[model samples]
Every structure is written in C-alpha cells, then in structure tokens.
Target: THSGTSLGGGDDLGAYFGLGTATGVDRLEVRWPSGLVQVLEAVAVDQRLTVVESGLLAELRPLTWPIEIGSAGGSFAYRLGVTNLTEASVEVDVWLHIEGPKGVSITRGPIRRQLGAGSSLGLTGSQNVPGGAPSGAYTMTLKVGTFPIAEQTASFSFSKRRGTGRAEGGGCRPGLGRKL
Candidate 1:
C-alpha cells in the first residue's frame, strides 16, 4: 500500500490511522514499536487524543475571602480571612479603602504576606477615628490581590457625655446603622 498514496508511516511524515467507514470509530488499537499494545475504547471519529507517559498538569484558582467587622474600643476593627487554593504558596497583598463624610477617602497600605496552599490567614486591624471627628457614615472596602472582596459600612456620631466613663462626649460612638 506504499504506492505514494499511503497517508502515513513515511520518512518525517509520522504515522496516521484512518477509518474508512462512516459509522464512527468505537475503538482504536495502537501497537507501539516497543512491542507494547494499547487499546482505547469508545473513541469517536475525527477526534484527537493525547497520550502522556506521566500525567502532570497545572491548576490555577482564585482565593476565598471572608471578613468580619466590629468595634474595638474607640476605633473600628475588622478581621479579614484569605484562603489560598493554588498548588504552590502565594503572597497576598491587602488594601483598605475608606470613604467617609464630605467625600473623604483614606487608602491604606499594601499589607503583604505569604499564604500556603489550602491554608487561610486571618488579619485583624483597626481604623482609629480621632477625637472630635465628624459624625457621618463610613464605608470600608477590603481589597485582596487588587480585587474588592468585601465592603462594610458603619455610621458614627458623637453621643452626649452621660456619665464619667471612657466613652466621653469627645469620642465617636457607633450610630444606628451598620451593614456587614
């Protein structure tokens, strides 16, 4: 069948297998030059299959984000959790964007840390509100790896000094609305 019309097994042309019928190839058999016989079942026609000796692949996944917000003394505190899903360890950077009254915005630093695969890291931080600060609502955005994961808004106002306690009239108190 090598009358120059053969489809394969020639010099630098590689080996090729052809199915003559239109009923779709149900099975394929391969006999390697190393005297190893392999059979594949339920294979369709005109489809390609890659055979690898040692199976190895690369996997990429996004990190998981969970956040919690609460009051820490005179400051607003928050706990952020980051879960890594990659095969290798990854370094994560955390950023905070705070939007307050009168179009005030505060951008926090790029807190960098290493996170192992399938492990989670918890970070606790507080945003201090200075004494006699304005009474208004604030929005805190948590950004992980250049993406906004979660946002929390809380209102603050100055309460009247009722008793001789740490929470004086000068300190800011949590207002009525708080959304997690």
Candidate 2:
C-alpha cells in the first residue's frame, strides 16, 4: 500500500516472495492497483520471467554432478564435475573426507571457486597414500560448496611385477602416471 518505511520508489511498493529449494511453481497470481488480476503458470526454475505491468519473478536452480566416482592416489587424481543451471554465477567450495584401511580418516579443505552461469567445471587433485598404509579398501567423499555431493570407494593393493613382466591391473600402464 506504499505505507511502509521503504526508501525506494513506487516500483518497489508491490509484493515480494521467496522460495527455497522448490523445483517448480504451478501458478502465480498478481493484482494490480487498477483492480485487475493476472496469473502465470508452469514456470520453470532458474529463470527470470517478466509480466506486463507486474513485477519480475525469479527462480534459482541447484548444483548437479555428473561423474561421481574417481581414483585417488599419487599415481592418479581425484576428479570432480559440477554443473550450474542458475541465471547468475556461483562459487563452489570443495571439501573431502577420506577413510582408509586400518580405521584411518582424513579431512581436507573448503576450496572456493567461481562458477559461470549455466556452465560446468571439471577439476582434479591428487591424494597421498602412505607407503606403510595397509592394502585394503579406501573411500573418498566429496562436498561441493559445503554440501555432500558423492562418494567413491576403491580397493588399494600394491605389488611389484616389473621383474616378472606381468601387469597387475587392466587399462593402466606402470610408470605412466605422475610420480610421487
């Protein structure tokens, strides 16, 4: 009613709304000062919709991940892929929690990054496994922007087959990856 203590012009005197974590909106109704009503339906998220003689409606989309599994060690890197669908850009913070054999657990940082609007990002980082670490299963969980994204589990077993001329694993050649 323009009776509030707002410093803006008459354009800011209308109604405002906010929706959190909602996927879609079925219908939105608006009433003008001239006693005319307008309704909009089937609106999608992460978009800016304009209405004639009415205010603007906006929606935000959440982040998504494509490749969820990866191998982490000195010879290979842990990869992450994220997709942003919102109209504006966003920053993604990465964190890691690793559970190794013999009840060992490690926590990594809150790395921050800026993501473009409606774009995807792929990043890779290395992880260190101690030489004395037992040969067993290892788990790595990833968190994007402080939210848990995905978890990858792999078995770690090392052996020396260079002298015998027999490879241990498939699709991987020895001395091909980054050395420690």
Candidate 3:
C-alpha cells in the first residue's frame, strides 16, 4: 500500500522577488506478466514484500550422532529438535539415514518418524555401529519431512575418538535443502 501527495508552488518555500516556483508530479506505470500495462497518476513511492509466517523457514536442529562399539556389538543414536515456523500445528517426518564406513555394513536402525505442530521430535533409535569402523569422519543425514506442508534437512559431520569412543559435535547447515 502506498500514499503520496504533491506540494504546489502555492506553498512556496524560497519564492519571493519575482516569486516564481515550480511543482513536480511523478507518473506511475506497471507492466503485468500477462502483457497488461497499468498507468496511474501518482508520485515516487516505496514497495517491498515481507514473509509473515507460513513462508518463513522452520528451525531444525539435530544432536550429534552417538556411536558405541564393544564386545557386545555396536549401537548408534541421534536426536532431532524441530521448531515449527507456522502458528498452526504441522506434521513433520524426521528421520536419520546413516551410511556405514568402508569395510563395515550396518543392517538396522535409522527410520522415519513424524513431528507434532510447533514442536520437535527427539529420536533415539538404536542401530548397529559398524565394527572396526575407520575412526575418521562419518557422513550422516538428518531429514525432517512434512508432506504438503514443509521439508527440512540437516547435513553434518561427526568424528569418533577411537580410545574414548565418543562423537564430537559438528552441527549441520540450516534450511530445507535441495534433493538428496
């Protein structure tokens, strides 16, 4: 919405002596995408677009992936924190997809689940932490899906300390991203 007014020379500011002044008006015109043009009698103005909610990106946070390995076998677990951007309740499918390190094959864990509106889903699913897994960087995917509503993703890296067997924090990037 815009409102503008023009100042006539009648309200002269520095007009004295011969007392002659000038007033100027701006002409506005817009061309629509449909090849239609619209002209209006107006002056200079300002315009912009602001996103008020639904369009805003939701907040997605994932805890570092925890992995354990021993004689009893190995296990993995991770959690997701969801912050609904919309005022109303929304459903989100948050899950983990872990790829086993070279020479190690994981057969279980990592599944899909939903999140409640304006809330988050904390998942602690147990999975086999690959044995003799190379103690280097690991690639993991933490995804949140809300069909017909919203989709969010968190891609991150975590390191495993061989002797201590603890995972370090390397938070993922924010935003619902491109495919895969």
Q: Say which candidate scores most in TM-score.
A: 1
Write the residue-wise lDDT of candidate 1 on 70-123 in tens digits.
222244444555555456776666555566666777766556657676667655
Q: How does residue 33 of candidate 2 score in lDDT?
A: 75
Off by over 4 Å in 2: 1-74, 147-180
Q: What is the C-alpha lDDT of each candidate?
A: 0.44, 0.44, 0.39
User: Highest lDDT, which number?
Assistant: 2
Cα displacement (angstroms), candidate 3, residue 168, comes to 14
Clashing pairs in 3: 90-117
Candidate 1 accuracy as lDDT:
0.44
In candidate 1, which residue ranges exceed 4 Å CA deviation?
1-73, 146-180
lDDT of 2 by residue, 50-160 (tens): 555421111111122221222222223444555554677776655555665667776666566576877665554444443344445555555454334221111222222
